[model samples]
Each structure stands twice: as C-alpha cells, then as structure tokens.
Target: MQTDVPVTDRTRVRREPARGRYDRETVHGIIDAALLCHVAFRDGDSVFCIPTVCWREDGHLYIHGSNGSRMLRALLGGQQACVTVTHLDGLVLARAAFNHSMNYRSVVVLGAFEAVPDDRKAASLDRLMDHLAPGRKHEARPGDANELRSTTVLRIALDEASAKLRTGGPQDDEADLSLDVWAGVLPLAVHALPPVPEPGITRSMPDGLRKWAGA
Candidate 1:
C-alpha cells in the first residue's frame, strides 16, 4: 500500500477534488512517465517558467543545466520552485464546447531547490542519462572535470507534491448527450521510433536501444 502526501495550502487540489491523487505510487508513476517538466520560479520581480528534462531518483527530483543558466544559478542560491509534469492521454470531445476537456495525468511539486554535492554530482549525472535512455549511460563516456564543473544539478525533495488525473470518455450533460453529435475520446500516446545511429558508428545496436524502440 502507498502512503498519501500530506496536503498543504500549496499542494491542495482545488478544482475537481475527485481527480486529486495524493498517494506516492500514483504521483511517482506520473512523474516517471514524463520526460520533461516545466519549472516555475520567481526571479527578482518577474516570474519565469522553463521546460527541461527531469528525472526522479530515490526521493528527489533532479534537473540539470549549464552552470551559467540563470535558472540553475537562481536555484543554486536556494530559491523555491514549482515543478509540473503532465502527460496528455486523450482529447475528450463533448457535445458542448464548454464540456470539452483533455484526459491527462499531472503532478505538481512545490519546494525549495538544493544543489547536488560535488562528490555526488557524477553519479547524479549518470542516473539522469540512464533515466532518459536506460542502459545507454554504461556505453557512453563519463563527464570530464571541466564538463562536470560547467554543469549544475539541482534537486528538490518530494516532500510536497500532488497528482491530478482525468480519464474516461466525454461527460456531456444529459441533454447534450442526446444531441446528434459525436462524443468520445481520441486517445493519444507517445511512441518511440527506431534508433538512428551516428555516422561512422561501428558498434552493433545495443539491447537497450532495441528495447526502447519496442523492436
């Protein structure tokens, strides 16, 4: 059984409370399925939201970028941030336009960011590569000293988070359901394409690539 995350003022799901999910399994599942996340934070007097690759390991969510990046610098300075990951499953078409909506699983994480220690930075980078392309990390060369010094990895503990999901067919009003119009869900999903190797590559395709392609 999974435990629920304590709901705080910021983590509360206000609209469609029935769609809210606080269980760790559900929240982690959604986070794991997403390849990218939008992180929102305030800088001085302006608010910024930037999209970047994100991965969860152990109990923390990690995102990396060039050391010179404003976002990374700000995060390294201990600024609070909000990260969101969403997967669109389908488009729900209802008889009435107002009732039309999307089927999606989304997670919102609110917390302060912390920089990964220098000693653990390499391992964190490896985990990130594996998360993006499992098993590929072993085949690639590790980051050099300069590269490691030029990059920044920030993490936020998964202490405050919530997941919201909306699934199933369109829910049109009773009167609209009887109208002469199509009302259903057009399912959507992400498909991995066959891998394309770089020019002059001599090594055979790895099992990881094959598995990722569903070959």
Candidate 2:
C-alpha cells in the first residue's frame, strides 16, 4: 500500500510540485472523503463537465446515471474522461491579496470509463448507497429488475491519479507579514444535518440514518 504510483507526463504536477502526491493513501483519502465528483469528457466539438455522485472500491471509481444519459452513453462508448474531487478545509486569508488561497485536498483521475456488466451493477449500486450513507442499502428495498436495467453504472480504474493538497496559513511576503491586516483561516467542513423523514412515514428514524448522521 505504500508503493508510489508512476508519474506519467500527464499526471506530473508542474506547479507547486510540493503539493502533489501520487501515493495510494493520499489519493484514496481525498476520494473517500468526497461524496461528489466532477467528470469531464469531450464529445465532437463540445466539452462537457458534469457533477455526479461518486464512490470508490477496490481501486476503481464508480459513477451511475440513467442509461439514456448523454454522459453515461459517451463514457460507455469508451471515451476518455477526467474525474476530480475536492474538499475545501478552510479559506486562507493573508495580508496580501496575492497570497490569499484555500486550504484544501483535491484529486484528479484520468482514464477511460467502462460499463459495469449487468451481473455486477446491483452490487455496485449497493456499494454506492453504502458509501454515501452507511447501511442504507440494507435498510432500503433493493432495486427491481426494471430499475436496474434503466440505470447505468460505469467504472474507471484509479491508475492515473494524483492528489494535490494545501494546508496551514498563507505564505505572505515578508513585507506583507508586517502589515496590519487580518490574516487567518476560516475553517469549513461538511457534516450531515438532522434527518427529515419522508412524509406519511410514521416509523421512528432508522438506525442506519441515525448512525450515518452521527445523531
């Protein structure tokens, strides 16, 4: 697990090289912390990037969409794509405007997508549900045959991936450090809000939802 992934021409980090990480842990950590990803792909004269829910397992990233979705259809056709996930930890304020930045972790994955076979779609869907909300798949009814058939799941290997991270206070110029200006980090985080049960459901909140929300 400690092995370093190869840095190919496309995966190399040229700017702020010190912030780039190619190891499995860094890349996977960023991916695991994120629940959504932006996927970009090119089709003919148009370039499209769409935000979608994502999950990872066994060194592969999974995304699901309608079988008739343009993005899914393009990916299922073996188009190359880029997937990116980012976590904004805080906003870095500096005495100098130029030094203002963000404390964050981000990952970029480059690869071609392949459709998950019909036999494996169900399990993948379960994994996705669990990833987003632990224990959800078990508590909810399983997808029916028609539902399964109408959905498309695609996977991309986490092979050509890299994570870039920034942390701590901004590095203001020596002169700016002496300036009388407010400088600090405003921390941010994503947390589950209290659950709002669906209308007409009289049962108590499920253990799964409560546990997932840490409530």
Candidate 3:
C-alpha cells in the first residue's frame, strides 16, 4: 500500500516549511536516485559524518563496510544514526546577491542500524550490485565465504524520514527584478560518460558492464 513517512520531532523540517515532504514516493525516489549517503553518528566524544554507498530495499536503507571499521561497528551496535542524501539540480541565480539559492532534492533518515542475518547476507549484497549495474552480479565473480565473513552489512528502517526539495527558477524581490542583470537557473545533473574498460583484453564488455557507466 502507498503511504507516507511520518514526521517525528527530529525528522521535521524547520526551515522553509513549504519545502518539506513526507510522502513515501518522494522519499523512496530521492533515496534510489543517489548512489551514496553521508551517515552521521557519534563515536565516543567526537561526532563523525562519513560518506558511503547506500541503497534501499523494501522499507530499509542498507550500507556495508569492513567488519573492523569503527563506523560500521558503532552503527551495527544499534547506535542512533542520521543518514542524508542530496541531489543538486541547479543553481538558482537571482538579481540580488542575498536572494541567490540552489535547487536540490534531499532526504534525511533517522534510525539505528541493525545487522542483516548471516543467512541472507549474500543475497542482500547481490541486490546492491544490481543497483549499480543491472545483471552485473551474475557476470562478475561472487564473493567467497571468507570475503563475506569479513564484511558487515547493516540496514536501518526508513520509518522516520523526510524529503525536502526546491525546484524551478529563483524568487527574486520585486524591486530587484527590475535590476539590469541576468537572472535564471543553471541546471545540473549526473552525466554518465563512456565506459573505460580494463587494459587486459580477455573478452568483450558485457551488457551489464556497459550499463554501469552508460557506455
């Protein structure tokens, strides 16, 4: 059933209330569109915000790292974490310097991460490979038992989350609009360049590999 992510005290958007969003569609889309997220969690007396690969499946967001990693170890221990993903769509230029802004899509998720059971770890990792390049999981060599044992896969519920976005042109002041200056939006996006294959020529590039960088 289609639903919305409920807003909690921490997940609530305080600035520019009009830009806040809590719909499931918006939240899921924003998460899926980004390849990485910045996870903020406290470690001892210091706070750390580290960027890592993130993917969504069902109602949970997933991340992985080496078992010895401090950040992964802290999160898998059920420490509260705040994950954020952002997409900069364009630069909103205005006639007034103070009015200049940016158009972006961002999502914030607050929850404690949990370990994925050992039995389901491989399948979950495969899903991540598919996310980056469809069918690539089958084409590439799979992780062996030792490799899987040394890795830690964790997931956090997306129950407490919100999406905030800004779109279109700038909202310049009435008085500033009359100024003799160029004002508009300069759009931006993630452009996939031609793929660069490895130096060794054992075989041709597979369809799955081509999709990875839009070759």
- Which whole-number lDDT from 0 to 100 does residue 147 have in model 2? 99
User: Per-prediction count of colliding residue pairs?
Assistant: 0, 0, 0
Best by lDDT: 3
TM-score winner, 1 or 3: 3
Candidate 1, after superposition: displacement of residue 174 in Å?
Answer: 0.9
Candidate 3, 56-122: lDDT as tens digits: 9999999999999999988977989999999999999999999899999999999999999988999
Rank by lDDT (best first): 3, 2, 1
What is the alpha-carbon lDDT for the whole of candidate 3? Answer: 0.89
Tens digit of lDDT per residue, candidate 2, span 177-204?
A: 7899999999888767866778998888
Score each candidate by Cα lDDT. 0.87, 0.87, 0.89
Candidate 2, residue 129: how far the Cα is off, in Å: 1.3
